[model samples]
Target: MAQGIRVLHVLGNTQLGGAESRVMDLYRHMDRERVRFDFLVHTEKEGHFDKEIKELGGQIFCVPRFRLYNFFSYRKAVKNFFEGHREFQAVQGHITSTASIYLPIAKKAGIPVTIAHARSAGVDKGIKGKMTRWMRRNLSKKADYLFTCSELAGISVFGEKAVREGKTIFIPNAIDCRLFAYNEKKRMELRRKLGIEDKYVIGHVGRFHYAKNHEYLLHIFAELCKKEKLNEDLKNKKSFVLLLLGEGSGMEGARALAEELGIADRVYFLGNRDNIYDYYQAMDYFVYPSRYEGLPGTMVEAQASGLKCVMSDTICREVAVTELVHTMDIRADAALWADYIRETADYQRKSHVEEMQKAGFDVNGQAERMMAFYENGNFDA
Candidate 1:
């Protein structure tokens, strides 16, 4: 028999993405003696966090990727999984695209609580995006509780009334604020280690994807490098460094674009980093040009680490918990973003941990509330 209340988190994978990272932070912070988190991921291949999760005594279950044609088969897979392992006290569906299908099944299988969590404010482009939108159209009707990372995400997935009427629970993407607090020693050490002590390191943390807007990010970096070439005091393009942290199918494309722009040597692609917070300390500036997001946790981490961030206006405004982050339109010219970074890069870096904690983006407090959520239906109460 299980020793604690088991909460099943349905995700695409336990990879190092925004949602995955945020959840993993909460898992590490939560009191495991009272609450334990298990994963029901869509992919069979082991994820980056699999080993850590197992070490923490959480079970991992896999199911096939759900396509529209395999709808019934996917339902069967979820049903069979629940039938064999009915230990879950609550099922929190992070993948809202299929939450409509799975949450109801979990409820039918005698799970007392079903949570449909909306973690993304936008969808992918083209046919797949259409499929995602179609699948989650009625997700709000299926789950016992509706949770959203941001108001934009709630309105997008659960409709405007659900959000406006306060039917949805707003769960900010919380992090371990202390981990990301500014440390001058770590900054100097890592910068020296990377041979970028003299360089203005521009950092970005996210997988290369259409939503992440890596192409736009590269273009902005290229523009910034061009500015460096013209600046007599800034020396040369070598003085500017771009460190992209994350990996995906779009990595090669970003690399090729960097080469085409003649800044290949200036860009470093650090794939799936475990010490991502340390990298934030080493960074002088953080830049995120994503097309959309559900209150990106990276922004909070960057702010906590005392790095000034230039954000895309498309993301939810809820993430600007600190005054360090400034928003610009994704449709704006790359030079405009470059101009902003150049003008604002010199601000004194100081940890915004207090602001993050006050804004409720700190993970420790939320983890306790989450434990209560799984144990009882009135999570907020």
Candidate 2:
């Protein structure tokens, strides 16, 4: 007999992105006895979450990447895997664009609960994305439950009618607020260790990608540096620092841009950090200029850490769990972004953990809610 009811999750890879991180947060807070998570990652290679998944008693399975050329093998792998392990209470797919392909297979295999979760608000451009979206929309009819991180995400993947008709459920991407809570002593200590004392630190935590708009961020930071240099009358005008975390394919481009702008010395690329909470504490401001999103989780963490945040207007306003977030249009010039950054950098820091709780983003409560759903074998309730 099985130890407990296991929920199967499907994803492209276990990379440290917003969706992956949010799911990991939920995994860490779940009750293992009542509900457990098993992963079916497409990538054959190990990921950042692989070790932790094993440590937490979760099983990880892999299938070949879904491509037109290998369509038969992909379907065969899914069929065989589900057949061999016929113990899943629910099969939840995180890659919304491709959920249609897998959820139907799970459904045909007699899995009781098939969930299609939409984590992003936008899709890639060109024929492939269009085809993927078309396939996802047609195939998503197999899912018993439709979940999305935000209303925008719901509309993007499941269609506006499904969202308006109450077919899609909006689940907040929650986090452990206490871990990101502001700490003055920690700020001082970390700043001293990094030699960032008396400096105006601007921080961003996301993969260096086209969607993240890292190039635009570098331009704006360059503008900020230029403006700061021209202003000799400003008080306490110490040096400036830009702290970037996370790694991706665009990292080389971002680094080159920083060097070209002659601001590479002030820009610190601290990739894939384990102590992200402490880094948040060390920041005076948080900058997120993502092109589009369902709801970026890092903004909430930034708010919890009491960092004054300047995010792009492309994100959902629902992400503003606290008053610290200021959203500006992505179409705005780099000088405008720099002006906003300079204007907001000196705001006071305070714990917004309680506000995050009130906004229904406290991980502990959300975890319990999900646990109950899993144990009850229904989300319709």
Candidate 3:
């Protein structure tokens, strides 16, 4: 083993989602002296983080697009693995497909350490979810280490037979606090720029998807609007507005739903922007009504930004480190979620801000931990 370790991180895409964001965060802050990082992405299409990764001095390898079961893809990926094998001390695969496809090759390449990282509970309903679980159970054991973002996610894949007695390790997503620190000036500026004034902003940041449950969020917001209209106390004290960030396949559907609800005027769909943190500053409350998660990075970022969060209980428990966050059942009625939103919208929360900073969910600490893990090969088994 050498004094400095070289690690190759393999992911299915380079998009600015939770998994990709975390990978970039780690790369940006990891100890340069102790660990060197590079990437392998399956897509040839450029992603939002590509330029940033290159600027950080990490190499990017592009693999051809192929179905996970495609033999040609495996052959090409294996060849690529051999080409970079000598340069990397270890290889870490970030998603199920990547893990299933590359772990065997890395093992054969005689890499000192091969890690299979499970970043989500598995994809939502479809043949895709079934195939991902099958791969996790059948192929994940090839790696020297199995890592998951949360205990729930690990169990969902490995089941009681494999991980209940402690076979896999849990490392919740880490956040860079400095990046989301409370910027009073920036918050005001963003609010002015967005033309959001004299209103309470409820924010949700994620790609539109079934798992994210954006339909439920719209329903909840509509309920809140109606409640405010009827309740004198609520009507006089505060106004409600929704801020939706990110774009995806379900985006147009989501926009249509908002229009159907007749609250389209009150909702702002900012699409995708590079300065998401700025939007966080302008938000008054954060809502994450996800049906499932591997530990959401947005939850951490929202809490770090000092916004009181109302998330689905299932996902909120994974991020139970903060008191500023509240949760309800994923199947909770719209009325219940609406009540929660109205109650917390006007509440002042300075104590929660202090708590997040104390917890070290901040970026620098997370980077140090990752750097140490790469340098020493210690996974706390």
Best by lDDT: 1
Which 10-residue window of candidate 2 scores lowest in summed lDDT?
Answer: 372-381
Worst-scoring 10-residue span by lDDT in model 1: 229-238
Question: What ranking emerges by lDDT with the best candidate at the front?
Answer: 1, 2, 3
Candidate 3 lDDT, tens digit per residue, 85-153? 567888888866547667777777767788878777747688877666676676446788878888777
What lDDT is reached at residue 195 by model 1?
89
Q: Give the C-alpha lDDT of model 3.
A: 0.77
Report the Cα RMSD per candidate.
2.1, 2.1, 2.4
What residue pairs are clashing in model 1? none
- Full-model lDDT, candidate 1: 0.89
Model 1: per-residue Cα lDDT over 135-197, one tens digit each: 888888899899999999998789888888998999989999999999999999999999898
What digit string (tens of lDDT, one per residue) describes model 2 on residues 54-148?
99999899998887678788889888888887789899998876677788888788788899988888876677678768877764476898899
The Cα local distance difference test for each model comes to 0.89, 0.86, 0.77
Residue 90 in candidate 2, Cα distance off native in Å: 0.4
In order of appearance, the predictions have TM-scores of: 0.96, 0.95, 0.92
- Model 2 CA deviation exceeding 4 Å by range: 1-3, 230-235, 377-381
